[model samples]
Target chain A: MNNIALGRYLPLNTIINKMDPRSKILILLVMMITVFLPAGFIGYVPILIFIATALYFSKLKLTYALRALKPMIWMFIFLLVINVLVMRTGTLLISWGWFKVYSDAFSQTAYIIIRLTLMIILCTVLTATTKPLDLTLGIEKLLKPFEKIGLPAHVIAMMISIALRFIPTLIDETNRIMNAQASRGVDLENGTMTEKIRAVLSLIVPLFVSAFDRADQLADAMEARGYDPSATRTRYKVLKMTNVDYFAMAFALVVFATDLVLCWI
Target chain B: MEAIELEHLSFSYDGQTDVLKDISLTIPKGSYTAIVGHNGSGKSTLAKLIIGLLEPKSGTIKVLGQTLTDHNLKAVRDHVGIVFQNPDNQFIGSTVADDIAFGLENHCVPTKDMQRIIEESAAKVSMSDYLNAEPTNLSGGQKQRVAIAGILAMSPEIIIFDESTSMLDPQGKASVNEQIRKLNEAKNITILSITHDMEEAAQASNVVVLDQGTIAAIGTPADVFQNDALMSRLRLDLPFGLKAAKAFQAHGIEIDAVMNNAQLVEALCQLK
Candidate 1:
């Protein structure tokens, strides 16, 4: 259940959550680009404000979003420290033996850290509020223009959606297979590296066999129901561009414009 | 009209020994027929052959009056649908609605008509409430029901349950069987159930016992069950109710060949 809550939908009926998935996707894409714009305070302030407002209306817990960023905090710090240590253009603030810390490096590292943290938070908010199916539909809708260029947009979207749907099921299967192996005296823990690798090998083979079997059955089932990849298909839910979606897209554009202007001035 | 006709069909996975050999059978329209056998008894191989998933090594298969061939395979598929054994693997859509709509999409069903068909099929399987629910969260039986609904939405003339209930618990199996029965009765759809469960086979209108790539017996359930030696030689276990009835008869008590536990219980209650 906890595993499901990681990136699962919360069903909150807020405006941000109710916005069209395509708009939310477009907003996220533009917001990502805005985060990389060069600015000291102006660029980040607007982004921070936008994200905060979206999160507030999205009704997603701040802590849950933060938890998604927890694993990357160490990497962020490592990059910050590396940037400070490697740059030699700015004035040296401190020297310890051969290592030096520069004034500009401190500001640069701070910028890197804040940009990354905000980017993660914003992306997390997009995923937390939108249903996985809606996300797939949104992505397919975005890819529609490329379909004329032989993109196979629907196939790609279906693959992604099916992969996302099976993740939890695969996790459970892995656990079940691990327990079955454990009962058969395959020690998973308290082992040498080679032994651990061997244990993983044992688990992998059965998991792969089951996955392949599933794929075979899925193919047969799809074929029996008249599924053909090359055939043009009708979609059940046609995405409508609502007023709320228009508003959200406009807001994203305004923020993007401001970020670009901030970088220029 | 014959819903399905297999004439002297032979199939071999490899070029060597046959998985199914010289099989001939005819299923009447609107009939519930069960093919019972042990694992590797070529029951599933027979089903795959009928569905045009596998070509016979020799002979011909006619489904719904159309002769199945590589050239006309797609046309044959439009009239027949199958729900395979593994419920988890067979669900192609992310959600219940999407899964059932998958078939409709393939058929190029108009958007408005698709919704009504989806709703009707879901209602048939009692899965109307779970339209938006993810397939991963569903139980084995519920997933199978969703799979059935997917088939039902296509409105195929014949629906094949290829050991679809073998993976579920007793309750799950019971509910799935009940839904299948309802589909056959309410819609007059022909059903071909491939299973090893004798109890399920006993309830069917006809039972085809397959052994060593050939039909050992094909008749009404009572007529087929009367051939005790052949069934025993095929290593097929009799249904529990029939076994209990036989056991009572051996002790100088008269009990007919009841098909289920409830019938057996009621017969025992009637004793003076």
Candidate 2:
């Protein structure tokens, strides 16, 4: 559980890591749209090359991207099976009296898997290169414009940052509760369905109680520190877009445009 | 001017039963005062009231000579900071640097000066090296230190510790206590520590014992600790030094009532 690396930052001094998180998040968004542009297998050559170049420059291995995909492997397989069975369009590849396989099904599923794999890898790259706090700042900056539409951007950003801050603490609390329950003659593993549910409820009840208690204390602490949501607060760590950030954003936009043009062709 | 003054302050979660009733106290500026009490004795409630986290049911609370009102609540909070008992909950930042930055950001400190202020504050708490470290990776002591650094960044004149060291280990408690002492003596910042540990309270310039939400006794540690009946009735133990002195007196050795271990040690050494 501790080794979950989906959004873990890799502390390195590479250029990709130095790029502004705003630019990286924007690039990820552009790439996500580009991946689904119906830009056939031939068009994916440049996209894959771009990703490989990114991974190389970011000082990250292909395994990091593959690791992000590992948890979703079963879901991908399930999707492939469902698509293969449901879609009845293209050239027939195999038939067994109502059981049939078609070329289009394989091709479509391959495109979907490729698209999903690229999206996941792109997301992984963004997270791996950017610190979580910086990512939150970038998000807050992006959401600032939406605040004009009555959106509580600062509050949302604070919530995200606080939630990120407490993730490890809550994880530890969960483990502690589990251990406490285990010691009290509660069999969490090999119990009957009802017993297992009861065991989980015991863990959840204490966790929820503690979480509420933590929230209450946190509110007091924030208040004591002079936090007023409506007041104007300055940024301590301001995000500045540098030359590298601009170049990266341009490169991602060009790649996406090229992919769209390829689809039209 | 006093750092904090409470007059006729009373509070209750439900209006029927009072948690704190007609409590009045004054904490002089630059003084270290410890509010000690058993569970549900309203020590924490008093701290919260002084910091304006909770409004008293009826009474006036003044901080830095200014009465606490809804209009000036933010201003009052700016001059007063709190380090809560649960280090994990009070830590509002992903990293030590960011945590210190939280209070400064709220105060609208200029970006140009934030880095310098944060570094100075972290240095004060001896957490300069761990600025980039995540709170999760830190021990309870380190987290409390970072929390102190957070309050220090704002340069609050008075800091209220709502049992901040209660959840820490003995070493952690000692380090935090040492920091609190330094802040009071060196920086001349007023300190109000609400603690269950009598030994910690003994080190304060003054100790206020609360029993059932009323002030049972208030004086210097030595003066208060001398009243054995009051200490027992309040379910408060004597400081380690005082307790040890009493035991020595029982065995035909006479020693004056000492407030802390160092005083007791010195007295024992001088007896020869």
Winner by lDDT? 2
What is the CA-based DockQ of model 1? 0.76
The interface root-mean-square deviations, each candidate in sequence, come to 1.0, 0.7
lDDT (C-alpha) at residue A261 in model 1: 87
Model 2 residue-pair collision total: 0
Looking at model 2, give its docking quality level.
high
lDDT of 1 by residue, A1-265 (tens): 3365456677787777767889889989999988998866668888888888888888877787788777788887887778877888788899999988888887887888788788878888888788888899999999999999999989998888878877877888999999999999999887999999999999999999988887788788888888888888898877778888888778888888998988879
Residue-by-residue lDDT tens digits, candidate 2, A80-104: 8998898899999999999998888
Top model by TM-score, which number?
A: 2
lDDT of each: 0.87, 0.90
Worst 10 residues of 2 chain B by lDDT: B230-239
